[model samples]
Target: MPTHHEDELDYTPTPHNVTRARTRTAHLAAAWGHPALAPDVALVTSELTTNAILHGSLRGRLIRVRLAVVDTTLRLEVSDPRAERVPHPREASPAEQFGRGLALVGALCDDWGHGPRDGVGKTVWAEWKLPG
Candidate 1:
């Protein structure tokens, strides 16, 4: 089937960009008639963006957020300038405030993975099946 929706954004690698990405994801989801998916989308976006900013690219580079719906699956992709540092879900302590993002993404998403982008970076993606 043809893609039902697609959008993307490129932002500077600054801390504020995390919030910007999340907000944009919410807007896109809502506009696509999936407003209820916004909260989880925002959460996933925040985590991936923050990780990209913190671990992937922090200088002289741009991070990208791409949203797409193919068939009935919603896919979110965050690309950063470091292909070598792929993210993985790990166990976090109860009191830890860090390193739970991938875990949350794994729990909330139907599937997620990372792959090399065309250029120097990697795109981390998460997918969810939308209700019919």
Candidate 2:
């Protein structure tokens, strides 16, 4: 299927770049004719990139963010250089600030999952259905 709108970016994994990713996701969503999805897209972007920065990043490796709109679906993917450290969503206790990122992604997107990338690393993706 042909893509309607798409963008890919590579960023050095850092705490600052997570905000950049979120802003970019929101901008892309609005430009793609899905303004209402901007917030959710941005939230998902933040969650995924933050997780990558905290858990999957390697020294001198870049994190990749890809956002695309195809047919009636909007998808966002975050790639990091760690295949072994996979993500699993679990309930978080009130005192814990972490452990809720994956859960939030799952709740916000229609579907979300992670898998190995080309050679080294993994790609975690989330998708939402757009208005038809």
Candidate number achieving the greatest TM-score relative to the actual structure: 2
Q: TM-score for all predictions?
A: 0.94, 0.97
Look at candidate 1 and give me any clashing residue pairs.
none
- The Cα local distance difference test for each model comes to 0.91, 0.94
Show pairs that collide, candidate 2. none
Q: Taking the tens digit of each residue's C-alpha lDDT, what string does model 2 give over 1-86? A: 88988999999999999999999999999998889999999999999999999999999999999999988999999999999999
Model 2 lDDT, full chain set: 0.94
Error of 2 at 115 (Å): 1.0
- For candidate 2, the 10 contiguous residues with the lowest summed lDDT are 97-106
Instruction: Count clashes in each candidate, considering only residues at least 3 apart in sequence or on different chains.
Output: 0, 0
